[model samples]
Target: MLTLYHNDMSVCSQKVRLCLAEKALAHEAKHLNLRAGDQQKPEYLTLNPKGVVPTLVDDDVVVTESVVINEYLDDAYPKHPLKPVDPAERAKMRWWTKQIDDSIFPATGTVSMSVAFHHQYTPEVLDELTRQRGPGYRARFALLQKGTDNPNFSDAIKRLYKMINDMNVALERGPWLTGEMFTLADIAYAPYITRLDHLKFLGFLDKNPRTAAWYERMRSRETYRAALAAQFNPKYLPLMEEKGREAWPRVKALVGLA
Candidate 1:
C-alpha cells in the first residue's frame, strides 16, 4: 500500500498528491499539522529524519523530497508516466524541475508565509520579523534564507523575478515546460505557480502573457484539481474554491494535463 505523510498547505506535499492523482493511484493520506509541529514528532521523524511533509512510504521503503517522490511514483506505477521516455528529454525535464525549485518555490513560500502568518496567527511572526531590527532578522531565518547574504525577503523576490521571467520564456515554446509533452518538470513547477496565483501574484502572469495562457492550461486538469481540493489549507479553501476556476486550468495545462 502507498501511504503519504503530508500537510495540507505544503506545496511539496501537494506535488506528491498530484502525482498520485495523475497516475490514478489510490493511497492513504495522513495529514500533519505543520503549525502544530506534528511532522517533528518522534514517530514521524523516524520516517523522515528531516521531519518534512509529503514523505511517501511505499511498502517498507520511504521516500523524502517532492521531486523524488514524484519520480518514484512514475517509476513504480507505470499506468501514467509523468517523465519523458527519451533520456535527453528526461534530463531537460529534470533541469526545469530544479530551476523551478531553486527560483520559484522559496520565493512563493517566503512571501506567502509572511502574508499568511501575519493574517492568521494570533501572535504575528512579525514579532519574529521585528527582532531583525533594520535588516537582519536574527530568528534563524535559516530555513527560508536559501543561502544568501541579503535579507530573506530581498533574496526571495530576486529569485522569484528571475523564475517568473524564465517561466514566461519557456511558456512561449508552448504547452509544457519540456515542450509539447507534459513531464516531471511541469509537475514540479505547477503547484508553486498555482500558489503565486493564489497570493494574487497574478501580476507575474499579467506581465507575461505566455505564462498566463500556460497557467490556464495547467489549471484544467483533474490531477491538479484533486490535489488542490485534497491539500489546500481549509482557511484558504473558500478562497481557493472561489478562485480555482481562474487558477487551476492554467496549471493543469502547464503540467500537460487536460
Candidate 2:
C-alpha cells in the first residue's frame, strides 16, 4: 500500500503528486493543513522529522523530500520511467533539480513571504514558524519579519531572473531540459514557474522564449492539471495579488525592465 501525506499548495507535494499521476500509481492521500500546524504534530513529526509536507509511505518503507520521493516512485514503479536511461542525461537531470534548490527555491520563498505571506502572519504565527528548525521555513520567518521593505528583495529577484535565463539556455539544447523526453527535471522546475507566474513575475517569462515555451507545454500536460493546477489554493490569491502587484514594480526595476 502506498500512502502520501501532503499539503494542497506545497510545490514539493505537487511534484510527488505529478510523479504519481504520471505513473498512474494509486496511493492514499493524507492531506495535511500546514497552516493549521498539522505538520508540527508529534505524529507527523515522527514520519517526517523536518515537519514538512509530502511524505510517501510504501508499505514498510518511508520516503521524505520531494525530489527523493519522485525518484523513489520511478525506481519502485519503473513502468513509467521518469529518469533518463543514459547516464549523462540522468546526471543533467540531477543538476537541474539541484540548481533549483540552490537558486530558485530560496528566492521563491523570499518573494512569496515578502509579498503575500508576511501580510497574513501574526506575531504568534511568526513565532511558531520561527521555532521551526527547517532552514527554509526559518528563513521565511525572517523575511516575513522584514515586511515588504526587504533589502534582499532585489537580489532575490535578480537571482531568480538569472536562473530563468539559464533554464532558457538549457532548453535550447532540445524541447525539454533533458532533450525530447520529459523527465523529473521538468517536474522539479514546473511548480516554481507556476508560483512565479502567480506572483506576476511573468516578466521573467517574456525575456526567455524557450523557458516560456517549456512552461506552456507543461501546462498542457494532464499531470499538470492533476498535480499542479488542481492543488492551487485560491484562498491566497487576494493577498498574493495585492502584495504581488505592489512589489512587482520594484522587482521590475531590479531586472531592468522598469
Candidate 3:
C-alpha cells in the first residue's frame, strides 16, 4: 500500500496530491501539523531527513522531494501519464519543475510569509515554529517580522511576476505549459499560483491574460478542487485574505503596477 505524509496547506504536499488525484491512485494519508512542528519529530526525520512534508512510501520504497515523488508516481503508474511522450516536450516539462525548486518555491514562501502568514505568529510561536530549522530560523523570523519591508520581499515579487510572464509566453504554444498535454509542469505550478490567488495578488495576473486564462483552466480541474481547493486551511484563509488586501497596494508598487 502507498502511504503519503503531508500537510493540508503545504504547496509541496499539494503538488504530490494533485499528481495522485490525476493518476487516480489510492493511498493512505498521514497529515502533519507543521505549525506544531510535527515534521521535526525524530521519527518523521528518519523518513525524511530534511524534515519536510509529502514524503511518499510505496511498500518498502521511500521517496522525498515533491518533484521527485511526482515523477516517480508517473513512472511507477503508467496508466494515466502526466508527462509528454515527446522527448523535447518532456525536457520542457522538467525545465518548469526545475524553476520551481530552484527559485519559485522559496519565492512563494517569502511572499506568503511576508504578506499574510507572518501576522499569524507571535514571537514565542515563531520561535517554536523554527526551533528545529537551525540556520534558516534567523532569516525566517526576520521575514516574518518585517513583512513587505524585508529585503527579500521585492525580489520575491519580481520572481513570481517573471514566472507569470513566462507562463504566458509558454501557453501561446498550446493549452498547457509544455504544449498540448497537461503534464507535471502544470500540476507542479498549480499550488504556487493558487497561493497568489489566496493572497489576493490577482493584479499579477492582470497583465498576463494568457497566464490568467490558463490559471482559470487549472482551477476548473477536478484534481485542483480535490487536492488544493478543498484542502485549504480554514484558519489560514481569513488571515491571508485580510492581510493580502492590505499588502496589494504595496505589492503593486514594488512591481511597478502602480
Candidate 4:
C-alpha cells in the first residue's frame, strides 16, 4: 500500500495529491499540522530528514521532494501517464518543474508570508514559530515578520511576474505549459497559480490573458477539485483574502502594474 505524509494545504503536498488523483492511485494519508510543528518532530525528520511534508512511501520505498515524487509516480504507474511521450516535450516539462524548485517555490513562500500568512501570528505565536526553525530558516522568519518590507519581497514579486509572463508566452503556443500534454508541468504549477488567486495577487495575470485562460482550464479539471480545492484550510482563507487584498496595491506597484 502506498502511504503519503502530507499537510492539507501545502503546495508540495497538493502537487503530489494531484499526481495521485491524475493517476487514480489509492493511498493512505498521514496529515501533518505544520504550524504545530508536526513535520519537525523526530519521527517525521527520520522519514524526510528535511522535515517537510508530502513524503510518499510505496510499501517500504520512501520518496521525498514533490517533483521527484510526481515523476516517480508516473514511472511507477504507467496506466495514466502524466509525462509527455515526446522527448523534447518531456524536457520542456522538466524545465518548468525545475524552475519551480529553483526559484518559484521559494518566491511563493516569500510572497505568501509577506502578503498574508505573517498576519496569522501574534507576537507570542511569532516568537514560538521563529524559535521552532533551525538556523537556515532565520532569514525566512525575518521575511515573515517584516512582511512586504523585506528586501527580498520585490525580487520575489519579480520572479512571480516573470513566471506569469513566461507562462502566457508558452501558453500562446498550446493549451498547457508543455504544449499539447497536460503533463507534470501543469500539475506542478497548479498550486502556485492558485496561491496567487487566493492571495488576490492576480493583477500580474491581467495582461497575460493566455496564462489566465490556462489557469481557468486547470481549475476546471477534476484533479484540481479533488487535490487542491478539497484540501483548502478554512482557517487560513480569511487571513489570506483580507491581507492579500489589502496588499494588492503594493504588490501591483511592485509588478509595475500600477
**Candidate maximizing lDDT:** 3
lDDT of 4 by residue, 27-50 (tens): 999999887778889989999998
Cα lDDT of model 3 by residue, 47-78, tens digit: 99988998999999999999999999999999
TM-score of 3: 0.96
The models' CA-based lDDT, in order, is 0.70, 0.84, 0.92, 0.89
> Among all windows of ten consecutive residues in candidate 4, which has the lowest summed lDDT?
129-138
lDDT of 1: 0.70
Worst 10 residues of 3 by lDDT: 126-135
List pairs with backbone clashes in candidate 2: none
lDDT score at residue 17, model 1, on the 0-100 scale: 82
lDDT, residue 87, model 2: 98
Scanning candidate 2 in windows of ten residues, the lowest lDDT window is 132-141
Q: Best-fitting candidate, measured by TM-score? A: 3
How do the residues 1-258 of candidate 2 rate in per-residue lDDT, one tens digit apiece?
999999887778888888899898998999998777899999999999988888999999999988889999999999989899999999999998888677677788777877777667676776777676544776646755675567777787888888788889999889899898889999888888888888877888888999999999999999899877877888976777777788888888888888
| Deviation from native of the Cα of residue 61 in model 4, angstroms | 0.4
lDDT tens digits, residue span 104-164, model 1 = 7767666554433333433344353443233355343443333223256555655665676
Ten contiguous residues minimizing lDDT sum, candidate 1: 141-150
